[model samples]
Target: MSPFWITAFLDFSADGFDDGLRFWSALTTYDVSPRRGKVGEFATLVPRDGDAFLRVQRLRDGEDRIHLDLHVSDPRSAADRAVGLGATEVADFADDGYVVMRSPGGFELCFVDHPAGVRPAPTAWPGGHSSLADQVCIDIPASSYDSERAFWRDLTGWEQRESSVSPEFSSLVRPEGQPVRLLLQRLGEQSGTVRAHLDWATTDRPAETDRHVAVGATVQEVREHWTVLTDPLGRRYCITDRDPETGVPPKPPTD
Candidate 1:
């Protein structure tokens, strides 16, 4: 099987598209790519100096959410592999060169035949804060956590590792040069469905949190080394105290 290049996407309702675009662009220091799709519903958030990894879509109907797109040389074969690994074909757009499938945890992913590229290096912001919106954290109910983690690991062929910070947190580690990383988070309690949100690994969490707030994101809650924030369009994301370059959390200070 061919390796897949992952891209994260923010799906917003038509009503929230403008705010989502403005807020995300400001947060990531990205510019909107020329709109595509018949009604101009799809656009990418192009980074200032790196390959683009984020995209936005204005859904004709449905609640706002985050999803992933797998770019491969052959969409049909990739989609077939996904199905073999417990994914269900939600929609087929092979004529258009893409297919939408639902993973076992119920997360939607699109497989496309677009050319793959290396993951762009993360960018630094003003005020000594450096980070990138390079991860999509999938929130899975405790009941489905193990299966979800396995499904993603099989689908992407990415190395799987558990986070030292929390047992419930695991990651489908991206290979070197892949832009987007998938973090599978097991919710403490059972939920009706699996969901996902964006996350940024930042050298300075406080500074990044403040910058996001200044640009229309609201601080929802603060944890030991991470802050949860709600964007202008009410979507949630996190700024964590992790190395932007390596995407690894800093080691705790010695006693």
Candidate 2:
């Protein structure tokens, strides 16, 4: 069976070997290794029933920010572990089973409660986990590799993953770990200001907005948290911090 990718990595400086080990310990319960020309390294916390990997490596001079979401069984607890590992909660909270987290590097990622954590196998879903949950990778552009990488590192506390993309397309990701991935890549005209926004599970929109604003995200539009806001660095990304019960994106105001 072909190994499918649950999460991609975010690349930062090629240092901090300890971070690599700590990351693995917190996310997966196994070893993450450099793949065979498959991009980078990969791994999983529990036993992997399908194909997944975490690619790690050092970064060059030019780079930027790449963001992704990681689904977990317990959003709150998983987030705490991330903080313990050195990542700081950016005040960005979602009522749903998800929380936005940043790595020590400048990459952005979230701890999501997938159907079965990383793998969505029906059997993978046990405890409180719903089914086979999965995090769809969403990439954000960075101004420069060093500046962006440092920003993500300070926030998430995770190190950079190695890059194996050919010269045609430049890529960066979190040093091969488990659970989720944070990736950043460089494209001549392919990169956009804001490709996509992250929507987390939440119950309240206004309340989540207040906290989100206090953390670093500036509220753009708050009809339902479906606002257009910029980060501390002026990067624009939208997020609707509303849960299913309390906040379900109101149907777009009929023009």
Candidate 3:
């Protein structure tokens, strides 16, 4: 198995970079790393107490979206494996140790070569909320749900299972040491495109939502165990009812 360090990225338009950086930093309680890249458009969010697993990019053009970066030991091998699993190559940077591809469902994924390291521990904030940005939920049309799920499972070599809380949700379970998990959510109707949003595992959903709202996010809706909030950049993310320390949903009690 090719070891992977899954990093979630928030890509924003050049015009939205400042606002995006400020909002995400406050929400996640992470400090912005010094800008890098030729145009100073890339940076990582540094956590106070753990390894960082989230980054921000300022795109020259295009709508803001979230994408995953897979840091592996061999970029070519991983990219080839992803291609065999129904992902198409979007760009290649072998010399630079990275390649970009689009998965079967059209979500952007990047494979990069990096040394294997320990997974970052989860972050807990004051007021009983935790921030993991550890899961990316792909919103797909009903027609593409099964195929998309199969594609991700084969691509990442991660276990795929239906969510216990909802039939429409399927989870791509990461390996024991992996930092990120993939979740596929079937929309009620066909959506125009397959897009991804970050999911934060929080111990307290209501308190987390309120914390985000205090930092410029607004509640879009409240579900049974999660609250969806739109960030200052208008991107939607969920504060879920999962343990902050383990990133697991509470287990059902045996009768």
User: CA lDDT, every prediction?
Assistant: 0.85, 0.41, 0.83
Candidate 1 lDDT by residue in tens digits, 1-255: 545578888999999998889888887778899999999999999876756789999999998998888888888889999989999999999889999999887899899877757577777665766788778899999998888898888878788998998887998777788787788899988855788998999887887777888998999999986899998878989988878777778888898
Better of 1 and 3 by lDDT: 1
Let me know the TM-score candidate 2 reaches against the reference structure: 0.30
Which pairs clash inside model 1? none
Worst 10-residue lDDT window, candidate 1 = 118-127
Instruction: Give, for candidate 2, the lowest lDDT window spanning 10 residues.
Output: 124-133
Listed in order, each prediction's TM-score against the native is 0.96, 0.30, 0.94
Number of the top lDDT candidate: 1
Off by over 4 Å in 3: 253-255
lDDT of 2 by residue, 10-115 (tens): 3333343335434433323335543333333222333356444333333443332334545555667767776765566775455756687765443456676544
Ranking by TM-score: 1, 3, 2
Tell me, what's the RMSD of every candidate? 1.3, 17.3, 1.7
Clash numbers, per candidate: 0, 57, 0
Instruction: Supply candidate 3's per-residue lDDT for 13.
Output: 87
Off by over 4 Å in 1: none
